[model samples]
Target chain A: MIIDFHAHVGSMDSIGARLTADAMLHAMDAAGVDRCCVFNIFHADAAFGNDLTARFVAAHPDRFIGFAFVTPHYPEEMEGELARVFDHLGLQGIKIYPPYFDRTVEDAIWEPVFAFAHARKVPLISHSDGRDPLVNPNHGEPQMFVRWAEKYPDARIVLGHAGNFRSGRLSSIAAARRCANIFIEICTSWREIGSIEELVSGAGADRLLFGSDLPLMDPRIHKGRVLTAAIPETAKAQILGGNAARLLGLAA
Target chain B: MSTSDFPVFDCNAALGRRHNRRVAYDRPDDVVRFLAAAGISKALVYHPYAVPFGTMEGNRFLLDAVAGHPELVPQFVVSFAVDDPDEVRAAAEAAGVRTLRVFPKSHGYPFVDWIAGPWLEWMARERMALWVPLGRNPEVDIRDLYETARRHPDVPVVLAGAHYSNYAAVWPLLKALDHIHLDLSRFDAANGIERLERHVGLDRLLFGSDFPEVDPKPYLHYLRHCGLEENGLRAICRDNLERLIAGERAV
Candidate 1:
């Protein structure tokens, strides 16, 4: 089964991304993706984003997996928001964006979220970019996740975009090597040639997950990277869906 | 449609190593083998050296690298700041180079008409296509590129590595200019290809991989499954580039 580990639903006017549930479903069906992990990192109110994600997943429960988005901006609301996301919303994972909050992933403000994920044993995915001049590279660098992964070994820490560029990919691979809890999601505008293969070889296929950064990127393009990577079918399968399935506790 | 059904002619690919990261395939033979494995029938290849190193030597290196590989078409990199326009034209003619790429930002030259006019004018005369990468680090200024392409309307300029972030700027460029084209390597905006087909039509879109920096198969898969008609698919995946390289303006 093909599962996209990253996707967004909502109108991000800043980036001109407006992905409704219907549009996301159409894209998923067109790309032959069996399931997707949907979230909204753009909404400032954590509950609003989770509500949007929950609504998107509720429309197509079988085909969509809802991931909760919480920010360090509302330190007081983090715990309660996460509980609502998991308990009431029935969301499976957590999504964070350090760049948007203007805080690094390792900041003291995110400790509660990481601690919550560890206690819940749910996956935590965050946007990670290295050396991208467009955004502050230091905000979401993959290396920052190593500390969290080591601290919260039970929590699945997926580096969204796998650090994005070359330096970021290398850092992601290094972080994944250091922590078994760490996973690399391959989705970025930077379609660096041989990146999938490099990620697999550097961090192992089991540690890599396929993501499209949907509504802003195409799933077919990211899926094609895994399908055409010069790797074993087993490795491809693992990266494509098996790893994500294992993280989300889905059927193999 | 399966990927094999479409004959892919990658219009933007590089054939040498860069200083930043290790590429999977850098040699000509490896690139050919890789592209063949990826089901690409043909590719317009430039050297990474051309951007960082001297254009004349880089172009020479590119010619030497793709030597005897019919599948790998030579794409020379020209810099008006470094190489004289006449010398470049003469070399391109001698080498039978049909496509020329420019890195105005990397080469430290303004992409103005006065600086690039001679080279672009020569390209227009020869019917050789010009490739400009918009998403590369230190991106090509869209305004400068717009002005340059506007001044030299005859040059079939292909914008390479343009991703979704460039949609707002690129959309107007496509609507305004018939000669301007977009490569699909990094144009991965959600349903972007379909949107472009509906708004701008498929004639201005061309298939490119930015290979060795990007994998081509995903884009091939994207084009095949993106809901375009077969004729439109053919235009984007292969024929459009052939037309542009042949100096035919968009219909």
Candidate 2:
């Protein structure tokens, strides 16, 4: 079961120059992805937030797993907005774009959102690639992710694109062992010299999530890379679909 | 151990501080392992941190990583941190380095201003080869470099990350440099590999994987399935990188 965790399928107007929904779905079909976690493009569209994408995912529940993207920069409305997505649209997870939203993963604005997710047992994910150091110095650093996990131990946090654009080193992730809920997603780091294997070894199988930035990269190879990785089958299985399913409360 | 076959030379790898924390690529062993699994026997690795600050710190770390294991990675593209042509030659001579590479954006320096001018002159004069990455973000001013190359009439500059979208942007520039080469990194866009080969003769293009960020499998799959002539594949996949690093010291 190839559940690609990072994908966006919508109009160019919504995604601001991306594959159309049908085109994205066809691309997914061609790539042999059975299902995908859907999110909106990180942009400034007022109506194109979690609610729209979550509703889209709800319609194709079989083909898509829904994730709502929230702007943590707007701390005042984060909690209410998150509640709207999860409660009204059945969004099991929330996607955070630090670069787009211009806030570090560890900002105080996320405190309420993280608390709500922890209370609701929904997960929070970010798009970072260890590139952005401060993420948004005007806001905060990406390492502030630790504070989220540390503060809300029950809230699961996912760092996407294998933690793109300003993620810390593996050792630092290891050092922050207190945030056991923190998981890393492998989407953009397919052919990367470093890999999710290092993160899996550092954190554990339980903390790794599989994502394919699909319609952007090939999904077959995305699944193939994980399956062909030098890890045990159990870990591969977990990353492929198990972890996401269990995280989303799809199975007991 | 030809780098072109299952090549693992990562072009777009990076380094930086995050949240008052640093996610650095100063570690060499891990890099070696990374290249190895990417099925790369040798690599032309670059360091983002060292280039911007004009520090040899990351480059030296890479040198140390492949010091004893010459078989693992035999060559690297010398970063533009070395200023003096005498010193650049000296450092390459000292480290046994060859094929200098420059990151126009990561270092936040216009290639023309920083070494592109004097450096192109040196490369032309000294018969040196350089890997110039061209992309949207940092925005390679190919017009400037190509114009400079025309004036110098000798430096060998190869385009590292040229994609289908912006290849046209560099079209006017490509005319000036008889020696400028383009590698097949983002072969996904229209007129991808097959188209590029047909448009520009096979020899002008090289193969590279901007790894640890973009996957090589898709690019490899594209090339393998693109139905290029075997001669074209051989030229791109192995022959070009081999020739670029051809006369350079094996150490």
Candidate 3:
């Protein structure tokens, strides 16, 4: 069973990427991915985007799992949105993209979101990329997430993209090693020859999860990486689905 | 059927020690060995140190390091700021260098036509290929590459290491330029390769792994499962780059 822990739904005009449920289903089928954790793509209305995700996941519960989305800029509506997503929509996790609001995961605005994830025992995933120096350089740094991991000790915080740059991969590994709560999701287009090996060695196989960033990235790329990595079969199994299954409270 | 049925030819690979502690395959032999083990039969490689340091030293290091391995082809790194255009051209010709990569951003060279005019002319005359690893810095923008390609129509230019962020600008360039080619290592956009193949011919796309920096296995899988025809798959995985390299004229 393969579980893609990172994927986006809805249209992102900023990057010219858009994916509907039908398109994602086709992509999943093509890549042979069993399940995927789907989330919103930071549209104009965060609440509406979450509703779209909820409906999409509800339509295909067996194939898709929903992760709630909340724009931290609207702190007043965050609590209500979280409640609606979890209680009404049945979304399992929280996803925060820093670049959309130009705020880091450790920013004061995200404290409530972090606190909620800790209390609920649901994993929190955030977009982390160290390559975008031109814009939002410090927003997704691995060190920032490490600080959050230390602060929110009980939260299962997964750093999405695992630092999507040549130099950032080391930072992700180092950050994951520094905090046990921080798990690195291996996604994005960038993969150092032994990046997965380094993650396994530093953070253990249980701390690494497979993510495709689908619609933004090809699922085949991430699947192929795990399948072809020099790591043991046990570790590969954990990365592909076992780790995510445990996080989502699903049967292994 | 296994994905390893066809041998791959990676066009953008790097060798030697890096100043940063990121790379897993730092040694030249290890780069070749790992690529071969990953089912890549041939690779065009450049030394990583050459981009930051003088290109002359890096080129020499690359030639000497891959001397024993015939499957590992040497791609000389050239910098107009450090090396004289005339001397570098002569040396490249003498060294049997068919393909050269220039890092304008790292080497502190402007991407204007004047700076690259002589070198571009020399490459065009020699029928050699010019590679630019774009999007590393703000200066190495895709627009500047389009301008360079516009200036030198005869030169076969390959843009390597381009990310999806530059695809917006790259789209127009793909439509306009015939001399332009793209390395498929960082082609991560959703259905990007398919889109590119539709918008531009598959002949303009070349297979690359960004080896030592990134693994070749996943990219090999991407090409295999990319849903292209058998001939299109062969062209991208091997034939296209082979044709580009074969265009290198000794005279």
For lDDT, candidate 1 versus 2, the one ahead is 1
Top candidate when judged by lDDT against the true structure: 1
- Stretches of candidate 3 above 4 Å error? A129-137, A140-154, A163-182, B1-3, B19-23, B80-82, B248-251
lDDT of 1 by residue, A114-184 (tens): 99999999999998988766665479888888888889898999999999988999999999999999999
- TM-score result, candidate 3: 0.89
The sequence of per-residue lDDT tens digits that candidate 3 reaches over residues B102-194 is 888888877778788887888888888889886534337666777877999888888897776766676777789888888988877766777
lDDT of 2 by residue, A1-252 (tens): 656777765533321225555655655665556778878755454236666786777677788877776665456676777777778777777776666654555556666778887898887777654544343352323355777777788888776665443245453355335576877676652244336566567767766777766544445545655764678898888887788777777651
Candidate 2 lDDT by residue in tens digits, B1-251: 22345444433333222233344233556655655655555556555545545545555655665577553332334444344557666777687665677665665556564456766666655566777776544335766666555666555567776653454555545554567777666533322454455555677666676544454544554455445677666667766666656533111
Docking class of 1: medium
TM-score of each: 0.92, 0.64, 0.89
Model 1: native contacts recovered, as a fraction: 0.73
For model 1, state the Cα shift of residue B196 in Å.
1.7
By TM-score, how accurate is candidate 1? Answer: 0.92
Index of the highest-DockQ prediction: 1
